[model samples]
Target chain A: MVREIYQAVADGILVGGVYALMAVGLTLIFGVLDIINIAQGVLVVLGGYLSYSLSTRAHIDLFAGLLITIPAMFALGVVVHWAFIRRLRGAERTSMTLLVTYAVALIVEGVLYKIYGANNVQLSAPYTTASLHVAGFYLPWIYVYGFLLAVALVAAVYLLLYRSRFGRSVRATMANETAARLVGIDTGRVGALTFGIGVAVTAAGGMVFGATNAFNANSGYDLISRLLAIVILGGLGSIAGALAASVFMITLESVVTIWYPTWAIAVFYAALVGVLVIRPRGFFGRKEVRAQ
Target chain B: MIGERGAKAGGLVLLVAAAVAFPLAFPDPAVTNYGVFAMIFVTAASAWNVFSGYSGYISLGHAVFFGSGAYAMGIAARDWNITGAAVFELLPLCAAVGAAIAVPFGLIALRVRRHTFIVITIAIFFIFQLMAFNFSFTGGSAGLSSPFLTWQESVYDTRFYYIALACAAGAVALSWLVRRSSFGLRLRAIRDDEDRASGLGVRAMRVKLSAFAASAGLTATIGAVWFYYVNQVQPQTGFDPLFDLTVVLMTFLGGYGTIAGPVLGALLVEPGTLWLNTQPQLAGASEIVLGVVFLVVVLFVPRGIIPTGGEWIRRLR
Candidate 1:
C-alpha cells in the first residue's frame, strides 16, 4: 500500500512539472501585464499543433523542434500584444483584454477545428512511452525530460527577474505601471516583450502535453479551467508559488484519483475554493499591493 | 428627433401589440423557435447585466446558476413523477437554488479583486460541469428528460415563446428598476472605485452579493423554462462555456448596461444564429462570426452600441 502511494506521488510530481511549465507563462503575464490571457490554453494547443506539423512533416525531433516552436510562439505573442492588448485603454482595459483574448481564443479554436477537424491526435516518439524503472516506480522519459526542463526554465526565469537589467523594468511595471512609466521605462515595450516571453513558454509545455495526451481543439476549455485554478492557488504572479501549488494540487488529485477518479477532479477544484476561503488572497499573494 | 415622451410611449404599445400577434401571424414551429430562443437569451443576458454590467465585475461563469436551475427542475420533475403543466411550479425552486449557490460563490469569489473574481467563477463553473457528468442522480451523462407535455404540436412552440417572452419581460423590468434604484448606483460606484465606494459607507460586499444573487436567481428560472422547452438537459447543454461567452457577447454587442441593449442584441444575434446554423454549408462558421463580432465590438466600440450610439444621437441633435 505504501509502495503504491509512493508510486502515485512520483507520478503526480512528474505530471505536475508539465503543468508548472504551462502555468509559468500564465502567471508571469498576469504579474507584469495584469491581464489574464484567457487564450493561453488554446495557445498551448496551438503550440502542440505546430510541433505536430513539424514532427510529422519535417520529421524533427520534439526537443529539437522547440528551437523553432518557442521562437515562433513568442513572435505570435508579440503580434497579439501589438494588435489587441496595445489597443485597449482606460478602466475597461482589464476586462476588455479578457474579452478580446477570449475572442482570439474562439477564432483560434475555429481555425483549429477547420484545419484539424474533430479527431483526436497524440504526439508520438520512442521517448514518449519509454519508462525509467527507478526503485519499483516507472517514470516515463517524456515526463522526466519535461520535469528537468521545467526546473531549468523556472531557474532561468527567476534569474532573469533577479539578475538582469530588463527584469528590473518588468518588475517595476508589475509593481506600478504608472510609476514605471514616470521613470521612462517605455512600459509598452516592456509589456509587449514580457507578454511574448510568457506565451513562449507554452510551446515547450505544449510539446510535452501533446506527447502524454491525445488532444483536440475542444480540449483547451478543460485545460484553461485547470490552469487558471493552479495559477490562482499559486498566488497569481509568484513563480515559486506556482511550482509549489502545481505539485501539491496535482499530487492530491493523483492520490485521490487512485480510488475515485471523479472525486479527484472535484477535490482539485474544491481545493482552490477551500484555500481561498481560508487564505483569501492565495498562497503567496501580495500582502498590501492589491491589484486595481 | 423621435426622442419625445409620447413617441416612446407609442413605440412601447406598438411593440407589445406586435409581440402578442407574432405567433398567431406565423404559427410555424420553426419560425416561433427563433422567437423562443431569442427571448430566452434576452432574459439570461439582461439578468446577467443586472449584476456583472452594473457591478463592473465581469464573470465568465454565470452558467453555474443556469445549470443549477436546470438540474433543479429536472430532478424535481423526476422525483415527484410530474408529467404535465404542473412542472412550471418548480420555477421558484430553481430561483432559490440559484440564489443558494450564488451566496457561497459570491462570498468566496467577491472577496478577491475583479481579475481574480473572473478566475474563481470559471474554476467553479468547470467543477459544476464535472459534477454533472459524474453524479449518479444527474443520470451520469445520459442526462434527464423533461416531463412530457401534451400541448398540440402546432401551438407547442407558442407556449414556450410566451413563457420565454414573459420571463424576458420580467428580467428587463428588474434591470430597469435596479438601474434607477440606489442599489444600481451603489454597484456602479463599486465598479468605478471599490475603495472609494466602501469608504463612503456603501457596504460594498453586501451590495455586490445581493446583486449577484438576484442575477443568479433570475437566470436560473429562465434556465428551468429552457429545460422544459428543450426536453432534455446534458452536462454540455446545461453548463456551456459558450453560453457564458455568448451572453457576454450579446450584452456587449447591444449595450452593456442599458435595458434595450441586450434585448436588441438578442433580437439580432439569436435569429441570425438560428438561421445560420440551419444552413448546411455554414458548419463551424457561426463561432468565427461570433468571434469577429466580439473583436469588432471590443476594439472599435468598447462602450457598446447603446452608450456609443446614444452619444452619436446626442451629438447629431
Candidate 2:
C-alpha cells in the first residue's frame, strides 16, 4: 500500500512537470498581454497534432519533431497576435479577447476535426511503454524524460526572464508596458514574441501528452479545464505559482485516486475552490494585474 | 413620465406581437424551431450577462450553472414524481437549488483574480460533467429521462411551449430591470474598476455575490424549463460546451453589457444557425460559423449588438 502511494506521488510529480510547462505559457501570456487566450488550450492540441503529423508522415521521432513544431507554433502565435489579438484594446479588451480566443479555439478545433476526423491518436514510442524501478517504485521512462525536458525548458524560461537582455525587456514589459516603451523597449514586439514563445512551449507539452494519453481533436476540452485549473490555482500570471499549483493539484488527484477512483477529479476542483477561498491570490501569485 | 412608461409598454406589445405573428406568417417550422431555440438561448445569455456583462467577470464555464439546473431538474422529475407543475413553480425550485449550489461556489471561486476565476469555473463545470458521466444514478453518459407522466401527452405539451415563452419574457424583463437599477450601476462600476468601486463605499463582494446568485438562479430556471420541454436530459447533451458557447455567442453578438443585446443576437443569429444546420454540407460547420461570427463581432463591434445599437440611437437623436 505504501509502495503504491509512493508510485502515485512519483508519477504525479513527473507528469506535473509537463503540465507546469504548458501552464507557464498560459501564465506568461496573461501576465504580459492582459489577455487570457482561451485558444491556448486548442493551441496545445494544435501542437499535438503538429507533432503527430510530423512523426507519422515525416517519420520524425516525437522529441525530434519538436525541432520543427516549436518554431512553426511560434510563427502561428505571431500571426494570431497580428490577426486577432492586436485589435483588442480599452475596457472591452478582456471580454473581447474571450470571444476572439474562443473563435480561434473553434477554428483550430474544426481544422483538427477536418484533418484528424475525431479519432484518438497516441504517440507510441518504446520509452512510452517502458518503466524504471527505483526506490521500490515504478516510473514510466516517458514521464522521466518528459520531466527532464520540462525542467530544462523551465530553467531556460527563467534564464530568459532574468539572465538575458531580452529577458529584462520582457520582464520590464510585464511589469510596466508603458514604462518599457518609454525606456526604448519595443513593447509591441515583446508582446508578439512573448505570445509566440508561450505557444511554442506547448509543443513540448503536446509531445509528452500524446505519449501519455489517447487524444483526439476533442480531447482539448478536458485538457483545457485541467490546464486552466492549474494556472488559476497557481495564480493567473505567476510562473512559479503555476509550477507549484500544478504539482499540488496533480499530486492531490493522483493520491486521491488511490483511495477513491471515482472522486479524484472532483477532489482537485474542490481543492482549488478551498485554496482560493482561503487565499485568493493563490500560493505564490500577487494580486495586482500584470502590465500588458 | 407616464406617457414614456406607456410607450415602453406599447413597444413591448408590438415586439411580442411581431414574434408571435412572424412564425404564423412565415409558416415555416424551421424558422419557428430557431425562434424556440433562440428564446431558450436568450434565457441562458441573460443569465450569463448578469455575472459576466454586468459584473465584468468573464466566466468561461457557465455550463456549471446550466448543468446544475439541468441535473437537479432531471433528477427531481425523473427519480422523484414531480412533473406537470407550471414552469413558474418548477422554475423557482430549480432556481433556488441553483442559487444554493452557486453561492458556495461563487464564494469560493470569486475570491480569485479575474482570469483564475474564469479558469476555476470551467474546471468546476468539467468536474460536474465528469461526475455525471461516471455516476450511474446520474445515468452515466446516456443520462436520465423524465418518466412518461400523462401530462407529457396532453395539453401540457403546448402549455410547456407557452411556459418557455413566459420564462423567456421574464428573463428579458429581469435583465432590463437589473441593468437600469442601482445594483446594475454598482455592478458596472465593479466591472470597470473594482478598486475604485471599493473606494467609493461599495461592498464589491456583496454586489458580485448577489449578481452571481441572481444569474445562477435565472439560468437554473431556464434549465428546468429546458428539461421539461425536451422530455429527456443526458449528461453529455445537458453539459455540452456548445450550449455554453451559444449563450456566450448570443450575448456577445447581441452586445455584451446591454440588457437587450443577447435577445437581439438570438433574433439575428439563431434562425441563421437553424437554417445553416439544415444544409447537408454545413451540418458540422455551425460551431465554425459561430467562431467566425464571434471573430467578426469582436474585431468590429466589440461593445455588442445592443450597445452599438444604443450608440447608433444616440447618434441619430
Candidate 3:
C-alpha cells in the first residue's frame, strides 16, 4: 500500500513537471504584461501541432523537433506580442486583454479546426509507449523525458533571469516598470521579448502534452483551465510558486485518482479554493504584491 | 442629442413591441422556430450583462446558472410532474435555482482577479456539465426530456413562442431597472475601480454578489422557458461554451454597459448566427465569426453596438 502510494506520488511529480513547464509561460506573461494570455493554451496547441507537422512531415523525432519549433514558436510569440499586446495600456488593460487574447485563441482554434478538424491526434514514437521498470513500478519514458526537459528549461529560465543581462532587465521591470525605465532599461523591448519567451516555452510543454494525450483544437479549453488554476494557486506572477503549486496539485490529483477517479479531478479544484480561502496569497506568493 | 435614459426607454418600447408582433405575425411554423432561439439568446445575453457589462466581472462560466436552470426545469417537469403548460410555476422555480447555483459560484471566485474570475467561471461551467453528464437522473448526455407536451395541440409552438418572448422581455426590463437603480450605480463604480469604490464606502463584494445572483436568476428563467420550447435538455446542449461566448459577443456587439446593448446584440448577432447555421459549410464558422467580432469590438468600438446605435440615433435626432 505504501509502495503504491509512493509510486503515485512519483508518477504525479513527473506529470506535474510538464504541467509546471506549460504554466510557467502563462505565469511569466502575467508577471510582465499583467495580461492573462487566454491564447497561451492555444499556443501550446500550436506547439504540439508544430511537432506533429515536423515528426510526420519532416521525419524529425518529437523531442528533436523542439530544436526547430522552439525558435519558430518564439518568433510567432514575438510577433503576436508586438502586434497585439503592445498596444494595450491603462487600468482596464487586464480585462480588455482577456477579450483580445480570447480573439487570438478563437483565430487559432479556427485555423486548427480548418486543418485538423475536430478529431483528436496523439503523437507517436518508440519511447511514447515504452515503459521502464523502476523500483517495482512501470514508469513511462515520455514522462521521464518530459520531466527532465521541464526541469532543465526551468533551470535555464532561472539562469537567464538571475545571471544574464536580459534577465536582470526583466527582473527590474517586473519589480517596478517605471523605475526600470528610469534606469536606462527599455521596458517595452523587455516586455515584448519576455512575452515571446513565455509563450515559446509552451513548445516543449505542448510536445509532451500531445505525446501523452490525444488533442484536438478544443483541447486548449481544458488545458487553459488547468493552467490558469495552477498559476493562480501558485501565485500569479511567481515562477517558483508555479512549480511548487503545480507539483502539489497534480500529485494530489494523481494520488486521489488511484483511489477514486471521479473525485480526483474535483480534488485539485477544491484544493485551489481551500488554499485561497485560508491563504489567498498562495504558498510562496510575495507579501504585499497582490495578484491585481 | 438623445439622453441615455430616453434612448434606453425608447429602444425598450420599440423592442418589446417588435418582439411581440414578430412572433404573433409569424404565420409560418418554421419561421417561429427561428424566433424562439433568438428570443432565448437575447434573454441570456441580457442576464449576462448584469455582472459582466455593468459590474465588469466578465464571467465565462454563466453556462453554470443556465445549465442549472435547464436541469431544474427538466427535473421539475420530469420528476415533480409539473406541467410546462404553467408559466408561473416553472419560471419562479427556474429563477430560484439559477440564483442558488450562481450565488455560491460567485462567492468562489468573487475576490479573485479579473482573469482568475473568468477561469473559475469556465471551471464551474465544466464541473456542472460533467456532474450533470454523469448523473443518471438528469439523463446524462442524452438530456432529460420535458414533461410530455401535447403534440396534437395546434398551439404548442405558438404557446412556446409566447413563453420565450415573455422571458426575453422580462430579462430586458429587469436589466434596465437594475441598471438605473442605485445598485447598478454602485456596480458600475466597482467596475471602474474596486479600490476606489471600497475607499468610497461601497461594499464592492456585496454589490457584485447580488448582481451575479440576479443575472443568474434572469438567465435561468429563460433556460426553463427554453427547455419547454425545445422539449429536452442535454448537459452539453445546455452548458455550451459557444452559447456563453455568444452572449458575451452579443452583449459587447450591442453595447456592454447599456440596457439597450444586449437587445441590440441579440437582434444583430442571433439572426446572423441562425442564418449561418443553415449553411453546412459555415456550420462551425459561427465561433470564428464571434471571435473575430470580439476582436473588432474590443479594438474599434469597445463601447458596443447599443452605445454606437445611440450615437447614430442622436445624429438623426
Go through the candidates in order and give each one's C-alpha lDDT. 0.90, 0.81, 0.84
User: For residue B1, what is the lDDT in candidate 2?
Assistant: 82
Candidate 3 residues A74-174, lDDT tens each? 99888878877788776557777888888888888988888888999999999999998976888899999999999999999889998999999988988
Regions more than 4 Å wrong, model 3: A286-292, B1-12, B151-155, B309-317
Q: Candidate 2, residues B1-317: lDDT per residue as tens digits?
A: 89879987898899898765655565555555556676777788888887888887877667777777877887876666665553345667789988987888787778765677777778777778888888888888788776554573434534554566677788888888888899999999888888888899899888999989888888888787777667677877777787777887888888888877888887677778888888998767777888888899888887787778778987997
Clashing pairs in 3: B254-B305, B254-B306, B255-B305
Cα lDDT of candidate 2 equals 0.81
Put down candidate 3 lDDT per residue, B1-317, tens digits, no spaces.
46878976796688668777886787577787788788888889989997888888888988888888888988877776776356348779889999988777778788775766777777677777778877788887798887776555466666677777888888878887988899999999888877888899999889999999999998888887787777788988888877787888788778888877888788788888788879898867866887787888877777776677668887998
Candidates 1 and 2 compared by DockQ, better number? 1
TM-score of decoy 1: 0.97
Shift of residue B286 alpha carbon in model 1, Å: 2.1
Chain A TM-score, structure 3: 0.96
Instruction: Give the runs in model 1 whose Cα sits over 4 Å from its true position.
Output: A287-292, B1-3
Per TM-score, the best of the predicted structures is: 1
Q: Please give the TM-score that candidate 3 achieves against the real structure.
A: 0.94
Order candidates by TM-score, high to low: 1, 3, 2
Standalone chain B TM-score for every prediction: 0.97, 0.90, 0.91
Candidates' RMSD to native: 1.6, 2.5, 2.4
Could you give candidate 1's per-residue lDDT for residues B1-317 as a string of tens digits?
56688888898899878887888888888889988999999999999999999988988889999998999999999998987889998898999999999999999899988877899999899889999999899987889999889888987999999999999989999999999999999999998889989989999999999999999999999999999999999999999999999999899889887888888888888898888888888898788888888999999989888899989998998
